[model samples]
Target: MQKNSFLTLSVAVLLVFSLQVSAQDAQPEAGVTPSSPFHIFDRFGDWARLNLLTFNQVRKAEIKAEIAEERLAELKAVVLEGASEDVVNQAESLSTAVAEEVETDVSRLDEEGRNIADLTDKFNQLSLRHQAVIEEILEKAPAESREALTKALEVSKRGLEKAGEVVLKQVEKGNLEKERAEKIAERTIEQLKKQVENRSEALKKITEELGEAPPELQERFNAKLQLLEKELVNVESNEQFKDLRERIREDLKATVEDAREFRKMHNVEDEDSDDILESISEDGAKVVERVEKILSKAKEKVAELERSVAQAQTNGKEIPARVSSLLDAAQKHLTEAVAAFEAKNFGRAYGQATSALQNAKNGNKFFEDEDSDEERDENVLEKIEEANKKIAEAERKVEEFKSKGGEVPAEALRVIEEAKKQVVLAKEALAKSDFALALRHAEFAKKVVEKIGALLERARKAVNSGTSNTLRVETKTEVKNEEVERPANTASSAARQPQVRQVKITAEGFLPRELEVKKGDTVVWTNATAKPSWPASAMLPTHDVYPEKGGCIASAFDACKGLAEGESFKVQFNPIGAWKYHD
Candidate 1:
């Protein structure tokens, strides 16, 4: 009996140990929380699962989308739980990894001649859900966790954009039925319209909360609201909706800037004041780094301009005195920026850097010889055609207005006459082979034609409302012939133009490991690998070995995010030197 008891006891001990090991290894379907000790094991489990599906690309893509959803859930959980910044960052990183994997898998599946219409549609819906969830999380997240959550939100946005692109490509390829594509486009437009409406409502609330803003602030808000109203009127196609979305995004950024100014002006303080201050401090450091990078690029541009001037002189072309003066001014500003940056005066450094960049751009304009190039001639011709089209459209709109019993304002008629005159001048300049002058006149004509259309649109609205018969045309100064005269560059300066260099990233690593490129040349890194890879400046994790700064991390040379298969990232090499980087 004692022997039997001993055997039973041993078995019991073995069972207990087995249970313990299983408990340690087991992970939830949605993955472990960031604070869990088994988090690493959960990640390892994900990797192992993905490896098992290597032969089934579609299945892999589906699994990846599910995994991305899990990561996104974890992100929301951490934010809602008021997790520490480190935990939030970890969650964000996890979400980013899975999202990138999904992106790469979709790309690979498409490249393999497989039908990915359904898969891309799935991803698109998933991304939209993720974006909504992230926006909700943003509202409730702690201030300290906002930055990480914001990054996670960006990842979701990128995923959404990529999936949308793929879906559109599938539609273009006729992989999806016409009805289904139309449905997809309609759904996308509806979603964007909802977002625009939400933003407008939020802005209205902000205005109400502020009670009384300065006249200029109120004017700015009104301008944005009016622009949004205009954008909302005619967005029927995917392309038009895309344009509207970008415009809304830009307006959102402007709104944020306006809010900051309002806060500073009123010395606003709230529960989040301390957090805002801390965030601003961090952003200030980034700003300083960005300014320093800008100065560095400005210096390189000035050097390039100098070389161009020397080349022009060598070719027996007269080097303009104003170009040299601008270059000198740029150099002086760069020096001042460097000193300000060293002194940790970020505001002054930013101003100096901006001035330096502007001066360099002005100097570089002297080297733009559009008249000497056939391609430029074509561009001018296109501009003239565009202007003529606008004038025709405006004339048609005026007739439509008059047919509706609306009277055209005298100013509107005058503007149309001026547009015709400008078009005539543009044609004359084109015949003379003065492409720059031709382009200038064409642009002015287009602008005048647009104004006339706007005037007619207002008049049509008034007539519809039975408010008035005459169009309201804003009084502005007309363009003069003398104001259009600008200096043109010689043909030799075109030789100094910047070129693009391609670098491929394969499974082995960056192809050609080392490369020689001139200052101002842009290098595009394309990923040909099966997996996602990040191309960053030397020193690994920190990525601070490069002289330039202001990337997502420590150096401007960094791609900042993983490039999926068939994806690409580009950066201009401004500071001439032997730079080291890795994937």
Candidate 2:
């Protein structure tokens, strides 16, 4: 009996409401014609209707609800015209409220608006219950997702609260402020949307992994979602309805497309939901087209990167890692390139044009090409070999310089300096058995041949710039902090002056581990490392040892244990001298 009565009344109410709406759509002045999309308003009447309602109060409220419903119908037409995202969200809200009103009024009509408070409380409790469920889920979330969930939950609550506020404010807000308040409501609705979308996205990911959800389960879930969304719109302010509806529609469309993609990729063969898969296939093509557009833009960026590389080289600058960009473009172009090649569509092609484009971009963009380390090793080996060749060449040049009768060629000096550096590095690398590296260092030394060319170039530059071949080395006043005892080895007062040096000596396995110095020209050392059986100090008692004191062993610090392992020692070589001492 109750079901039959309820059905009959529902049909009558829906009919009455439908006719009223049709009348309003035909006439704009009767109610607000929605200019914006998606407007479902949370009514202020519920707050006012909390009081117990007499029969007369009930009748008055019913009249008021019908009037509001009429206005809504008019607004529906307005919103459907071209409702923006903001408007769609708001319209849905108003629709939800309308639904709620019908549901409640069926139980007991309230045209007089006397007793809506209890009903409002009931719906509010439902909303709170839903929030509690969300909060519980958040509490159990893993650490990685907890932060995002917390932020989203807080924002969503705010959005709901703002929707409520906009509804309350509409009653009191003047015409001028109505526009401003509606804007606030629209933004609030958008925030709610973002929160829901993120939640749905995460849920979709989980569901995808689980394989096909049962048809019954999907339908149930969808039904519950629709209910929840309807409630959400009803709770939001009426002024925000248009914007709310628009946002919801757009979210729904995008969400469907996204879900379809997930289904296409992860669906089991012979999966359930033929309808779902069909929808996915259709929407996925559109999404792919959109992605292709992005790829096109990326290709252009790669081209521009190439141009930048060429420009940089013209100015002698290093290349950039548009390396990644070039690689991406090559991959993208290869899609079509391979197809074309496979079909023998010889479009003036040897390799894909994209490869050349990529190569062009790569030309100036200096990067570790795939085997860069191997190449570097090869370079090192080459440099070492060159250094050895140059050493022999320089020895011959040294004779040539001397044969020029006391004019040591500057070219010879420069080559000597370079060869000195190469020799030091080679010794270090050799100690490490980095033969490949050692060889490279040796090769660099041979490049000393180039220094002869640099010398003539410099001479030419000096002639061009009208500068002198020799530059002056000026002597400045020097201060001495350490005590200095001058010797008569220097006849001149100037030659006897001490020179201070801050030198970092790395004789890792050698004696006299480190040295500190001040202005002076002499040094002495006490034997510190090597054999424990020998009295170290006694072996070289007076410290008159020269670098050659121990047979080339002086230079071969690693072989002598002349330096001890894990023993740190330092010395003060103030009044600096060649100071060559050995133990």
For all candidates, what are the clash counts?
Answer: 0, 83
After superposing candidate 2, which stretches have Cα over 4 Å from the reference? 1-298, 301-360, 364-398, 404-494, 498-547, 550-583
In the range 1-583, model 2's lDDT, one tens digit per residue, is 9999996775555445444543442222223334422212212222223232224544444443444444434434333243443443344344335434533552352233234433322223222333333343442333334344344433333323322432333324332243444444444334434444444555464344222332222332332232233223332213334454354555544544444443344332212122322332344233223223333443564556556656657988643344445555555555544453343322211123324343334432333234353564566656666666666676675666456332343444655665666666665665443444456456555554446545545544433332223211112222247455333233443454554333222322233333433333223222343422111221221244223233433322112333343343233332212232222
Would you list the C-alpha lDDT of every candidate in the order shown?
A: 0.59, 0.39
State TM-scores per candidate.
0.35, 0.19
Q: Which stretches of candidate 1 lie over 4 Å from their true place?
A: 1-31, 199-206, 211-583
Model 1 RMSD, rounded to 1 decimal: 30.7
- Writing each residue's lDDT as its tens digit, candidate 1 over 49-119 gives 55742457786687677667667778877775667778877887878777877888777777676778777
Error of 1 at 540 (Å): 44
| Candidate 1: residue pairs that collide | none
Best by TM-score: 1
User: C-alpha displacement of 457 in model 1, angstroms?
Assistant: 47
